[model samples]
Target: MIKDLFLSGKTAIVTGGGGGIGRAIALGLSHAGANVLVNDLGVSVSGDSEARNPADTVVEEIEAQGGRASANHGSVAEAKATEKMVEQALDTFGSIDIVINNAGIIRMGEFPQMSRSDWEAVLRVNLQGSFYLSRAAAPHFRAQAGGAYLHLTSASGLIGSTSQANYAASKLGIVGLSRAIALDLGQHGVRSNCLAPSSTSRMTELTDNARKHLMSPEKYEALKRMRAASAPERIVPLIAYLVSDRARGINGQVFGARGNEIYLYGQHRPVRMMHAAEGWTPAQADERLPAGLGAFATPLEVITDVFTWPPA
Candidate 1:
């Protein structure tokens, strides 16, 4: 049996804690003894409007289970509001020890058809919100001598997806941001990591393909036959470990997490150098296509097949 990884006196602030994977993580943290501050604007999956009660409901659930918790309904997109949200945790729980930056939204459209508003909205919440919260929490963590950040990214961030350019860009940006923070905060005893999670959530429900796969018995059974499958709870163990003292030495890492499988994401491949003449013209560039493209192509047999898990 696994031992209890209790936080006891620790305090945590979980953004987007009202629902989906965020709520799951928050509840898990509370179960482990942390006094949690659940921050959720409680917006719809498209982030169209607010639902403040969602945040309240999560807080009620936590308290009902004998866990100490408070609810905050605020937009992480607002820097001042985000800072204030973090302050609520400090004020209520005394100090902030963990931050789970799990709030995000998705607005899908083909690249040419996607509206500017959709693109900006997605970036504002998914990328800038994480930045605002991290900036607000860094100082407190520094003063306290330690803390942890777990950003909820997506497998789509690691691999490309159709009609999700904005979402993919934002999620990838998170990985980059976390890496930079991990480097800067390591000396201050703060750690930052990203989790590319595959879990059933309201966000995933927006996609017809995902919903069909999740709700249809045949598809669900097919998923079970796959080598790797993951539930939201499977991600909790990693998040719990990262926030604990056990992960002090593990920094600047990204994880691919799903039901029962956790894989480490390593260094990215850099663009390779190619030989070219000093005076290579546009025509020459076109002529060298076969050679230039050779290095980037996948095997012919696999080109038509879809990959369940693409390379990170």
Candidate 2:
């Protein structure tokens, strides 16, 4: 029997809630008893502005399902705008207990040819936005003596990738930021963690520019095939579990959601150690370090490596 995860009397702000993973998680949180503030800028996959608002659609869906929800179209890229969104949630819902930083955009280009604007656009939404929202909510959380932050990270960040330098940098930065937030807020009953999710969504469809930079043709084909089995909804259970009261003990951790598999990722740790009584010469260190550390070195994994296999 599937037992309902209880989150009654809670209020949440889910950024990028108009569609895809954000939409699914917003609905799930509502079903679990949280009053939701669905925030979406309704931008294109590339972060360009759009006319129709997606957040409204999500709010309507929640209401149709007999759940409470509200909509916000504030862009998380602006710090003040994100702060107002948090305040709006508090004003509308009467309290804010959770913040899911899922608003992000993709501009996949190989590092050498990637433009400055492309890099800044990705970082603005993916990393700075999360930081701004979390910063906005920190004081409120501290006052309440409890809150949760759920950041959408990626395996691309964890292992690195070939064509998406901007995306990888922003995602990896989120993990680092969340870890630091967890450390600083733990005493105040605030919890922060990141979700490295692999699933098919609008994001899975790369732009023409990104496709031009494809490193492995066969891997790209496999990714296209795998999307048939991937569902945005498959990622919601973990989001629900993490934000629930039951998961109060979980903090500053990275968890992976790939199909039915749930993975606990280890933080960066020393794999091999070397010490010299006195600082060794550069030549001497180069000679000995490879033998010790190189033995444990892992080959760099491409972005498609994580998503090429179909979900079972």
Candidate 1: residue 304 lDDT (0-100): 8
lDDT of 2 by residue, 1-312 (tens): 143647788999999999888998899888888999999999987998888898998899999988899999999999998999888988988999999999999987778999999999999999999999999999999998999999999888898676788999999999999999999999999999999887777887664225634546676566666565557788888888898878999999999887787888889887888888888899989889899788788767665664556666
Q: Which runs in model 2 stand beyond 4 Å of their true positions?
A: 1-5, 207-218, 306-310
Residue pairs of candidate 2 with colliding backbone atoms: none
Worst 10 residues of 1 by lDDT: 302-311
What's each prediction's clash count?
3, 0
**If scored against the real structure, what TM-score would every candidate get?**
0.86, 0.94
The per-model lDDT (C-alpha) reads 0.81, 0.87
Model 1: how far is 80 from its true place, Å? 0.7
Error of 1 at 121 (Å): 0.7
